[model samples]
Target: MHLQVRIDIQRRRQFIQIATFGVLLIVHQHHTGQADPDDHRLRVFYPRRPKAHRITEHMDRHLIVVSDVIEPEVEHVLSAGLSAFNDQMTGINDRQSLAVTVRNPDTHQVLGGITGRTSLGLLFLDLFYLPESLRGSGLGSRLLNAYEEEGRRRGCRSAVLYTLSFQAPQFYEKHGWQRFGEVPCDPPGTSRVFMSKAL
Candidate 1:
């Protein structure tokens, strides 16, 4: 009976530790939106409380996965898990969002723009789009330059992006981006071009 009581205590402590850490992670992420990064490992942090801890033993537990829908709570679970693991590994957290919006001159409705981020001294260009009306008017270059300039201001030393072969690879090259890698993608003869530039 004593041994059983001890085991119960240990299990309860484990559950409390896990639950407390999970809550801390969620609160941190909620306050500061972050994603996984290598330059800056996908990480999140909360106010100082304790040294980092780890769960070493693997547990066998039944699990159920629900799919085919977006759940904010589900996303928090994923984000917290990843951020915790990455934080444990790197002991560093430095990820930031960087985006530029293009809006209609007349109505001010958003047309398109660049979306990316800076982490660990590197700028990541995630998406860039300009409608047909704005493609060739030198605005694309301005936007690209703006994103890069802000990245530089944020201490990023380089920039990276991927573009489809049919999707303005030349436009990027014209802005001095170099193709470092390529992978065949959908649409015959087309490929995803990975490009990078030194800031």
Candidate 2:
């Protein structure tokens, strides 16, 4: 009888200890920055326009704006169908691609161009360009803003991208992103900087 009584007391003591440890763990997590994983995520939805303005290409001698879907026409021009081959070979790989071209609209003389990509919860600013005539007129700013807005609409909480040292790191910094990491090039010599922004 005494042995059974002692065993019961020991079990009760262990239960109390476990309960106290669980409470302390929860309190410590709350005091720190950790929350329950299930409680930490938020979902947001963006209302869509019944008719979103289709981004179209403007054909001016000095400038043009266009959006390209990887389809028959783009595939034909690249001489590769819209399959694995085209995706691998195209200079720009984006699900939704948009661009502004500075060129002779009639001749389609491409002088300079810009490109952007948007996909599931992410937006990438892949490329930008301007002819000598259009560099200082704030086109780059407009493009960046457009991409951010689009990213928000796509339910993205953040946008990420990279730039080379010779590229526009300072420009992205000015637009409200911070550098998170960098790779100084491929095979030990490419010198690239990575950055990201929260929307």
- TM-score to true structure, per model: 0.64, 0.44
Tens digit of lDDT per residue, candidate 1, span 1-199? 1111111122112222223323322111111334223222212333322222322233343224334565798889998898788778888677789889899889999999999988778999999998998888999999999999999998889999999998899998999999999999888898999999999
Q: Candidate 2: which pairs clash? A: 57-65, 58-65, 184-191, 185-190, 185-191
Point out the worst 10-residue segment of candidate 2 by lDDT.
Answer: 1-10
Candidate number achieving the greatest lDDT relative to the actual structure: 1
Alpha carbon lDDT of residue 51, candidate 1? 29
Full-model lDDT for every candidate: 0.71, 0.57
Which residue ranges in model 2 land beyond 4 Å of their true spot? 1-95, 100-113, 186-190
- What's model 1's lDDT at 71? 76
**Deviation in angstroms for 78 in model 2?**
18
